[model samples]
Target: MTPPPTDKVVPLDELGDLVADGESVAFGGGWFANHPMAAVRQLIRAGRKDIHAITVVGSVDMDLLAAAGVLGHLSFSMVTLEAFGLAPNVRKAIETASVPFTEYTGLGLLIGLEAQGRGMPFLPYRGPFGSDLPARYPEIYATTTCPFTGEELTAVRALQPDVAIVHALRCDAEGNAQWDGTSGPDVDMAKAARRVIVTCEEIVDRSVIAQNPHMTKLPGYYVDAVVEAPFGAHPTSHIPRYSMDAWELMDYAGQAGTDEFGGYVDRIRSESEDDYRARVLTGRDVVLAALVDAAETLEGANL
Candidate 1:
């Protein structure tokens, strides 16, 4: 009999073992969608520290890491909580200068990842005109001329993260990941990182992935591990699965930056991933799913 394929699946708790402390980690998600939050929580529970976090358009994930005192540095184009308000913990960290940061223009950050994915030392673009960002980071951004046309352009250094963590809709035991909704920069982040960890809402057989190959954004070859973490993107949204937990987020916003915040972090730190789901998701999960249905219904009505 033929041997079974390598099973890359691991328990969520083991995620911390795959990543070393003080490594640069690219977090996958944008504007509160599909962040590998379960992994983030696991890191906190494991007491991992001094991590350099990179995000394209971060929200609660970045703030929670900051609040947990897990980040040594942050690199991002934007970090906001949208209607909930600015990311309070990130703001405090930046204002206090406690954590060093590199602010890339949105496109600059993505291009940097793209450059690494293409195996280039750097990539050139038209650059963001009238933005003070380029001048601020002379080391990361510089003027370059195209050899063919002699046209001036801005070159951004390639960004390679030590590890990338992303949440997916589902994945096979072999780590083939599928995303039914917004994938954001998960693919690019995975491709550019030295190691990639995919946390999915469900783990299925290879046949399920084969049936929907087009949805397989990150092939198993690029994935280092697959973790099954239902509601992995809680408080954020994974769409087609569930909507953002606005109520929970509002509670988080209210507690963030307050004396109560430590208690909140402690609560998470003290609980296992299973405990967290039992406490926060047991009853509310159905409601969260209904919110997605309600949103789609509203969108259809508008259309």
Candidate 2:
């Protein structure tokens, strides 16, 4: 397909300025699946409320935002990452009847994005055909019939988001995003979005994009903002830079309650992004000095 004409690029903050209340937005990544939620976080911080937040699946990245009530509607395939935070907390939130949401199976949601990307109203799939979910979700399920026998069948709804935030290995000034690792539904979700926010580990010159166009997962036309955010994935990934820490994630998972989470957020909020980079994110040390110091002081432990 031909790329959209004229790439519209802007700073991350300026991009957030465009977001308004009560808009349904599709968010890419599974619980911090190496995709930085910083841009999305900024939106939440900017007093933006009543926003519809959709993910192919949930991860730790989403826990705080949903719990904080920044989301008006929470839609996704599932509620928790078995590797990270426990599932019960989010499931409890949904079951409270206060949160507005509907769940679709993984394959159903993925095909929805593919359909939207192709500009189709709905995408048909084989599974979830005889399940109770289709009849349960009219917004996602449309009626169909067997092409061979002309019998009734079901088709799932197309997935589209008002905004899709995608973090990647790199993106160019023109907004061409490159993903060098396992990408689930991010690429297709970006294409299905009305506005695409591309946050890259680094933004390079257009020449690099031209050198290997095939490497780009999503073209500039499909993307709106080109943000250079290093270590943006945090507990998720900084792909090719390092792998995710399941142990640290498990530790973080055990730390319960909103107060603890608020404390972490409070601590991180004290520094600007520059401070984070200068002190920790961009350094070339054997270990983060602060982490080492804390580890040394662990109760009943030897370093």
Candidate 3:
């Protein structure tokens, strides 16, 4: 087993400057329904091109990035399901660009992540017992072999990234990051990247993390940049800071992931950095109150 070369250490802010043209990036998020808008925002601000993107499933994040005129390729397991699949904006961009996007089987992509973390060239995945993707992605299936089948089986190669940008609920000044909620693609995300930059809500004292180690996910040593950014993943919920905008999410889903994507773009475009800060200052309490309203308004369109 051979692993890809060791990735170099770099700061998160430097990420926009460091990533070489055509480098690959593995994003850590849930299904298309679950992604970090702040992380996506950072990438959009940089607006790099010819980069590969990986997500378990993505709707706005992928669509927004693609619309920003970046994204050379995409590799994923599933886009959307149990809600809505294939974000409309993403689909339109894919259709417009004719990008050679590939969907890896879930199990195969997991195996690839396992291999990448282990510093292995590749690893075998047994899922996709019967599927067309294996045949389409020969690289993943390059050396398909199976002791059970006694026939060659296809498998995707473990992949890593040049950099990964993820948001954490809290962290220490040294860059130890953590989440305050359920598990996410965080571990795979950090492992898959040569460097990781985590934005946290509250960058606390290191000892505070030591008292409750569960709060910190990746170690400070592994992190390059730890931006103490509160309300980072705005309109996207911050767990304790906010709850999922069920109605908003459903609305976005109902529109096939495009619903008001352009509207969001325009909204952001209308505001400059100063405007953003002013908006944040004024909107903080309003946003908090909205989060408090939660399910009451979830039933109606007051928001």
Candidate 4:
């Protein structure tokens, strides 16, 4: 008889302990969907600093970290708040040259992670033609010729982050994570990272995960730790469970880059995750869940 598997479960507060200052960290999620906001908050609350953040399409998650003075370097394809406006903190940091940054084309960034996941030094593809990005980063991008056809292709170097944090719908104690919707770049980012931390709305027993194996995107072997954080992706949408808290985002947008922004960051730093939920998510959580139900109802009616 085999002994029980090691329980990878950990408290959210320990998230900061896994990451070191100045280490490259790949944040999972894209375009305000399923970002590890809980972990992001924990990092700030723990007073972690000088993080080198990487994202494919970031929004508030990146901006909040920037506002908290946690970022020393940023590498990304895009960081926008969509209807709210640009990511003010990131933009200001870049404009002031306070945070060094590298801007990759969206495809280039994904391919770089893919290269690492596949154990390759680099991967070649028909990259963005006539884009000035290639010329700017010679070390990352280069023109290569196919040995057989002599066709010119662009090559992207591997991008392996020191750690990756992703939000899942649910995970087991052994760290098997499942996502009901909008996994985004979580899989690729997890694959390319040296260590992975999974924060989920709930942590179930291994039997629960086994019941729905199809939903398990990241197996336990790839995950270093599992954190149970209900509403882990608040403000960012975690489909099927709840929609984004647009009101919170709008409020954040208004305060960002203003004198009040420091207070906002300070509140997050001072509170526990439970306190944050109590303060901001109390009455709003129900409405956010209703929004998801309403959208699904509309979609079903349309069908």
Instruction: Choose the strongest candidate by TM-score.
Output: 4
**TM-score for candidate 4:** 0.97
By TM-score: ranked, best first? 4, 1, 2, 3
Reference-based TM-score of each model = 0.96, 0.82, 0.77, 0.97
Model-by-model lDDT, in order? 0.94, 0.69, 0.64, 0.94
Stretches of model 3 off by over 4 angstroms after superposition: 1-15, 18-21, 32-34, 81-86, 142-154, 246-274, 277-303
Per-residue lDDT, model 3, residue 288, is: 55
Q: Candidate 1: give the clashing pairs.
A: none
Is 2 or 3 the stronger prediction by TM-score? Answer: 2
User: What's model 1's TM-score?
Assistant: 0.96
Q: Which segments of model 2 are wrong by more than 4 Å?
A: 1-9, 85-89, 268-271, 276-303
Angstrom error at residue 34, model 3 = 5.6
Q: Residue 90 lDDT in model 2? A: 57
Give the higher-lDDT candidate: 1 or 3. Answer: 1
Point out the worst 10-residue segment of candidate 1 by lDDT: 294-303
Cα lDDT over the full model 1: 0.94
Error of 3 at 94 (Å): 2.1
